[model samples]
Target: MSKNSIQIFDTTLRDGEQVPGCKLNTEQKLRIAKQLDLLGVDVIEAGFPMSSPGDFKSVEAISKLVKNATVCALTRANKKDIEVAAKALKHAKKPRIHTGIGTSDSHIIHKFNTTREKVIERAIEAVSYAKTFVDDVEFYAEDAGRTDNDFLAKVCEAVIEAGATVLNIPDTTGYCLPNEYGAKIKYLVDHVKGIENVIISCHCHNDLGMATANAIAGIQNGARQIECTINGIGERAGNTALEEVVMILKQHSNMNLDTNVNTKLLNYTSQLVQQSMGMYVQPNKAIVGENAFAHSSGIHQDGVIKNRETYEIINPEDVGVSKSSIILTARSGRAALAYRAKNVGYDLTKIELDVLYPEFLKYADTQKEVNDQDLHQLLSSKDNFKKSVNF
Candidate 1:
């Protein structure tokens, strides 16, 4: 991988589908796998094969279908889970088995009723066992966000020595701030022996609404891969949004990082996942949201109309949005009103616009943003214009 190239590891089918009521069937998972491939994600975490027979088949089917991206299966750090995942990915063009155990003290003592040493042993053994099935093995230190950095570095070193090709440092509970997360990844890079030979991947949750921020910080600190989901759908609040991270890198060339993601497919991919998972992307959500490119404030609408760069850092077409929307609300100005009018087949002169502006405002106050149909009604009605004072 190039030093500035970031790998987009999409966990939508595995982590995203784990949301309650969002579980996808085998065929549905396959459909999303195909889309993720088309979107140029570097790795597709297809499913947790050991979770269910349905999931096993879904992973197996996706493995057979995906031709470009590496098809990966998630598993616990154990023989049974690893074996099942390997078997499911048997036919993949490029296959990976992602297996790991929790590294945080809370997960070790309470969740597993084990000691730190025992957790390390399990992680090493799991990665070594997985390496036997496939040359590509990723070891995740679950809940590493809260794990002691020194101990986390130790675990990462042991796994890399044990033949792990990728080391995933996950903020599994979304517990770390951006600075903390970046420091954690930087510590691993500096302290973990043989770290340069393997990829450092970040998997972050959004409990505090900082998953994307944390992931970016990870890359800035040397992590090379981001594990994210389409539409940010995942457990709890959600995972890091794929579109958010990709566009961030694209927009801020100063970051000096780029991903394989074909950004034009981002909107379509988000929509497909939203529909498949029965989840809605909030209007103000970043990147692929409905309002991401819509300008409504008078100042914003005018700036966007004159030059999109004034208000928009990203072009609507860059992410497959047909065009930037200049919504005509009561807050909109004459410039936006005239822009919309021309689109719907009317060209209002400045004098004519001044005449229609107040009536447009009166009608817009009664509703949300004025749509083309509403504008037509306001423009074509002689009675409505009759009330307007001549300008």
Candidate 2:
């Protein structure tokens, strides 16, 4: 892959499942794993194998099902977790073990009650042990976002020396600003020895609503892998959204960055994960939301009606949406009314539209939106416009 090509590490089945009440069975995991491979993600973080018997089964099933993407299993910095993960991924065509420990001062002092020197030793040991089972070992520094840049660099250098092929620097609590996160990654790139041999990965959370922004910033600073989930679902607020990051790189061609993702399948994949997990995506969420391509405001509706590009940066069809919706609301303009009227088979002239506009507004004001049936009723009430109504 080119240096500009970013690897998409989808953790929808792992971190995304961590959302309360959004657990998936082994069968559901296999289905989603196949779809992730079809969606062209470079790596699929299947699950934390040592967490539960069911999760281990799901990871094993996904490993056997996925044909292309590298199947990765998460593990703590211990021999037992790594061994369990290895056994679960035994059938994988390409398997990866993701292992690490806390590196931040808060975690070192309070969470683990250990010293920085011990944390480094554990990180190196985990990566080295994981390397024995799989050639591809990804080492994460838990809470790396808050870990001192110099200490983080030292840990990264140590892990790389121990055969870590990928370095995941996660904003575990979603604490860092975009600039701060970018600077952290840059500090590692410039400070860590033997860094050129490993891929720098960004795994951000959305607690501060900066996960996607921070991921982009990390990319700008030289990280090449983005760990994300579909619809941005994960612990707390969520992780960086797969569709958001993929589209950002595609939309900003000048960034000279690209991913192997199949953009057309983004909406399909989002819905699939939503249905499988029983999680409802917010109406206004970006990319895959119900309202992403829906226009209701008068000015915006008119602009979108005139030309889709006037309001939409992404083509609805490009993301698997059949078309844009011009929802008829009290805020809708004459252009929007005419456009929707034409779609339901009524081509109203200026005189007919002028006659029907007030009646339509009266009905629209009383309801949230004026559907085709409501439009038909409104047009039928106007004696002069009644003759032009299609139905």
Candidate 3:
């Protein structure tokens, strides 16, 4: 587990709160922080302390409460911001001052209106300054996805030399495809000095809906940590989902990466964030979505009844999701009718189920979803009629 460990750096408090109309207060942040710790995240990005006094207080309180995971404060590539961030995290059992600057030309020319050389110098200074207050410092090259690979490598190597413990390469606008992002991480893995000693981290945004894929690509190429948010909540499109990435490692690929996440806590954690943040998750979202394991189609229900493995790649209970329904609809089939019937305590024989499918379809035609009572009533009526005939 130690060798294959994948550090989960959750930024739900910082990035997630940035979503429009989803701001969370200090108490809400503290509650979420305690849960992320209990859920076993390796690091919690409490907030950007320099953003406001409220943010600073939230980070300070969260830092005081977190017992296991390192509590981190986000900062920009300036001594003032890094100092503010460092002060906010001073009470953390394990404090980290995260400081970084934009590396891509777009950010340099437009956002900061500066030169690339100046950005690199600022990055080195920020990481060095942060290191003075906290032994654990993480340096992110914002928009690294669009930065020149050679310059990105140089920036990463300089930060590592400046006492930074982690190098975060972020797909800031979610621009790069998976293959390209993987190549970027692989290049750093191969080229950066003492790169093996520093944890190579991936932070991907989901503007192209490729954040999870990009993060996974980073892992395959030697990244050991994923900087993500709960339910994929973050600025704009969002960040990689912590639960999605963790369960992907546990259930699907041979990635063999381990996170401290208890597989069963995913749904609860997701719901908590959604409610506290006032953001509703799309029903079709992955991992903790309401419909992730649900089936309503005829062919899919039949296949699933024959073998769950035919339809479901991961078990529902594995992520704290209850068994999803083969929701009765006009598209349902005999297998689904039988499956639903048995769940309500009616052990219908294949022959009995064969007869009930059409009746279930009639209900499906009118109803959005079939109820357990209605299915039982339909089956019970058929049983009574058969017994009367025998009598």
lDDT of 1 by residue, 133-196 (tens): 9999999999999999999999999999999999999999998999999999999989989999
How would you encode candidate 2's per-residue C-alpha lDDT over 203-228 as one tens digit per residue? 99999999999999999999999999
lDDT of 1 at 347: 72
lDDT of 3 by residue, 137-190 (tens): 999999999999998998898889999999999999999999999999999988
List candidate 3 stretches off by more than 4 Å.
1-3, 349-355, 376-391
Most accurate candidate by lDDT: 2
Better of 1 and 2 by TM-score: 2
- Evaluate residue 71 in candidate 1 and report its C-alpha lDDT on the 0 to 100 scale: 93
Residue 231 in model 1: shift from native, Å?
0.6
- Which pairs of residues collide in model 1? none
Model 1: which ten-residue window has the lowest total lDDT?
Answer: 382-391
For model 2, the local distance difference test gives 0.94
Task: By TM-score, rank the candidates, best first.
Answer: 2, 1, 3
Alpha carbon lDDT of each predicted model: 0.93, 0.94, 0.89
